[model samples]
Target: MPSREVHTATITSDGTGFYITEPVFYAEPNYEKVNYNNYGMAFRIQAPPGAYSVYVKTTSDAADTIVSVSGMETSRLLRGGSWDAAKLVPKKYIATARGKEWTYTYVNGRDYLDIEIEPNKINTPVGVEEIVLQPIPPQQREDGSLPTIFILGDSTVKSYTFDETPMSGWGQVIDAMFNPDKVNVINYSMGGRSFKNAYTEGRFNDILMSGSIGDYVFIQFGHNDESTDEFRRFGRGSTESMYETYIKEIYLPAIRERGMIPVLITPMSRVRGNAAPGYVYTNSFINRKFPDIMKRSAEESGVTLIDLNSESVKFYNEIGVEATTAVVMSIEAGETPGKTNSGSYANGHPSKKIDGTHYKEALAKQFARIIVTELVKKVKAGDSTAAAIASYLKADVRVAALSGDWSKIFPEMAGDTTTGEGAYYRNQIEKLIQLGVMSKDPLGNFNPDEEMTVGEFIRCISKLMNLEKSTFADYPNGELSREIMGAILVDAYHAKFTSKPKYMTDYNGTAVVPGDPDYDPYMDPGSRGAMYYPLVSWQQLMDTAQIAPHLASKVKEAYELGLIRSEKGIARGQMVNGTELEPKVAVTREKAAKALYFMWVLQQAVKAENDVSSLK
Candidate 1:
């Protein structure tokens, strides 16, 4: 059996064969250290003969380094990646890098892979390890005719080599779910890149250069975007601030201009343990936070959205958290799968933190299948363009296990619960949930009957309206009243509801001192002080609780817009099949969530009609 040992060797820092990290033994006068100012010194791996066809590995959660290899006739492979040990930045198959600067020949007759490691961030360690020369493969055919899907995002979407084994990205192996003869999957995602970074660093620009009209772009960036570090923050200041600006100005425009389709995707949940009984995991980062932002972007930008994050969440819930932990990057020490001739990953746990963030190949395949299933389901359901794209996606086996209803894997979604499969409001319940407008608890229970707290209702309204969380004290909590709901509804839709939210153009307009729209308001507009003493509404006056008597006018307005619903068969905002009751009745989580989703669907309908009008 052929093994990497016979073909690859690590280049050593010194002329003699020795180890600093991995196997370090190679003769090269190209590498030199450069001063890195106050923090630490920097170095470079220069080459004209620069480590041709070599696979580089970086370690310690370090995604800070960038590699630029001067291309020479002697060098076929010229890309650097995150450490395979951490299972990040999957090793390359074809020569690929962050930028499009791979064409420089004979730097003093020495082909070089110039690696410039930036000063490391104080929070984490970063280092370059094993730089192995890869065996040259047969020349690959250039087939621009085949429809290619370029994946863009973070490490979770990058392609991992077989040596990484169990830890794999769905985008890397999603090709198996399609007929390669017709569809080509090119994953350009790097570990730790925010979608914004993908554009800022020129990966998206490269796509503009390479992608043809018929090609597709799948973008799912949130993992690293959720970073607390401002330098790495992509999801930055939630939807309105960083996220909205980037999608509207950069991602959507760039992909659409090339005549290629852009499919916005949400990041999937990690197998972070600590589950409450019944439900597996309850991380809402991807479940609600990022998905909500992306969905809004897709809606405003007119792009298709594939809710992979929601689908994965459903799958995890059905499989149970314990099983999912194992399915992810977990293998009990010696329990690692038998090594293939390709190579083997180091056995056991990399650290005590556990590999909840990554998945094994088997699980990656399933997740890949889930993506295909979603594509096909949407295609058949009246999406002509999606159907056209689906024609290229030829899945046979892996997706066979999942039906069109794979998204409804959870009992709550399937209506196979205390309410039973044939329960009333089942479809409404499922729609609100499958869309992830609402989600079950970590225990895998929807708690549909549980009363909705004032806080919970505000949260649901925010999700439905895609409202921006502006300030620190902007948090919602307690039993909700008509007044609070009115305040929330008004604030959520201030952008389009009452009137299109106007940008602050004048400093003296109100109390603002300087900067127009850029001025920061430190107060929550929906707080009690703001919402109090407004005109009472018909709905509130009707409610004996006298709830929200202060904001009656706005409450009535929201009711007119059909965004509110009480537990009654026929009432304001009662778009769902049936209702619970009249106003003053305590709201239930399920009911509030259902009402929010209904409002969102209605808004989408209005948007579609407006689009048609514009076309006409």
Candidate 2:
């Protein structure tokens, strides 16, 4: 039979894949881009050559939405359908969030699935939320029952939506790396899930219920387990404690009893946090104690272990720090040129902020290859367990090298420092550029004297500290104010230090200010009846009405910490008893560089102190 040529139709996308948007011949002739109710969307499923059933789930805003297979004479009602005819199977329906499931059988391993939306009289916009492609196994096993590989991990291993494009998981593409005709791959991983939460949420139970004997279950976690706060499943104890309580005591035994092979994989390292200057790895989450705990758990449980942490660290280091941004979900405003489903993310949405933890499609595919390649290596090393799963890999599959000119990742800094050899900030600026803490403009000029904005300053600090999930994208690119910069410096300080900074603790001063709640004009003769009130603490001094209430205390802390330099030759409104903050004044690039240097120096002092404590 000849295939249908639907090239003239516009393509509409679901979460992970797209479908053709053909005109709804039965409904209005016009294809409404704003309201999809007047159009039909379809996608052809291409799977391995075999007799199987395709299960689809869809949701729409309109009640009269129809789902039917090709070659059908009339559209079936959403309520009921014949099993033999392959029509709509109503799972459940709600007025606000209506959903339905449909099943279609194919003997030729392919079929055209179409979703038809009709224009509703109520004028409510209609759309399809999700389309899940579930390929049902054949009734009879021809090749001795092919085993399934189950993946259990965090966001780095879960499938992402089309809107979340460029943010893919290794598991999403791992199946393609293997010979699909030989085995099946199912990913049970979810974002923001720790091992404790996953097990508690019955995710493991779902896998055990569906898995059979001789199947492989690959487990990886530990992106969220490091949280110290009570929320997000915190206080679940340390990494070692969680490993012992879950893997050694429970999960491994359960899998072994079920006769399924369990393979433990260490979570991959983050690009920013793990990349150290002149080193393969830094002392971040992966390098600290988590990977060691994973290794110990695998060793004691006698499970096949894959050290993804070490391998990924090596990969990031080889690619260099600046190039790491290419693989991860790090994009500056308007950096990527594709239109998202919402159309808002194109011109620099907040979601486009720097993400060091997640991987883009290219790196995700590479990581999948690395996982399979490691299994192949294990098989070559004569590991019987790895040998069992090595047959599923495609012929001669190898890890691909991350290509691109590394030198071009960050253009050379074009600045003249020869005339200012004695200038203090020149060396500091050079160090910042070399460390990848700062980059030159697209025109290749460092522009050291250019006034830094709040966004630029936050980014520089974030890079220096390797802060994950920095949420300063909304900060405007206008010249940064001293007061706002003070608040941000305190944030950076708290990221590393637990106690109050030495400067804040050492300060002892009081000030007289007006408009205080405790102000009594006639109470003190020293006030001169000007409604003056004594500011007893440094916090009170910085908690002026001009600053936002939430940031006022932080600004005060930053000022006392000596991170904020008092302005010289200040105006009348800026000076308070010869202590001029000039809080509203724009910070120059030179001053910003000096402030960052002070913060870095303080961080080093804390690090040195901690190192000495460790020695003791």
Clashing pairs in 2: none
Q: After superposition, how far is residue 7 of candidate 2 from its true place, in Å?
A: 68
Q: Over the stretch 1-616, how does candidate 1's per-residue lDDT look in tens digits?
A: 0001211132234432222222222222332121111122123354322113544455433244333222111122344443222343343333443321222111111222333222234433334454554422222235556777878877777665423333567776676556788877777776667755554344555554556676888888877766553332121223335665567655676565556778888778776643434664555584227767788888887777888878888887776655565456553212221122221111223232346677654466567777777777777677765676677765443245235433323333433322322222333344455455566676656666667776666655555556655511243577765455545655566643554211111101122222237533342212212110111222333453454455656656554333453333322111111222244556665556545544443344221111010001
Error of 1 at 160 (Å): 1.5
Cα lDDT, model 1, residue 422: 25
Best by TM-score: 1
Over 422-461, each residue of candidate 2 has an lDDT whose tens digit, in order, gives: 1224433434565667666776556666677888898888
TM-score for each of the candidates: 0.43, 0.42
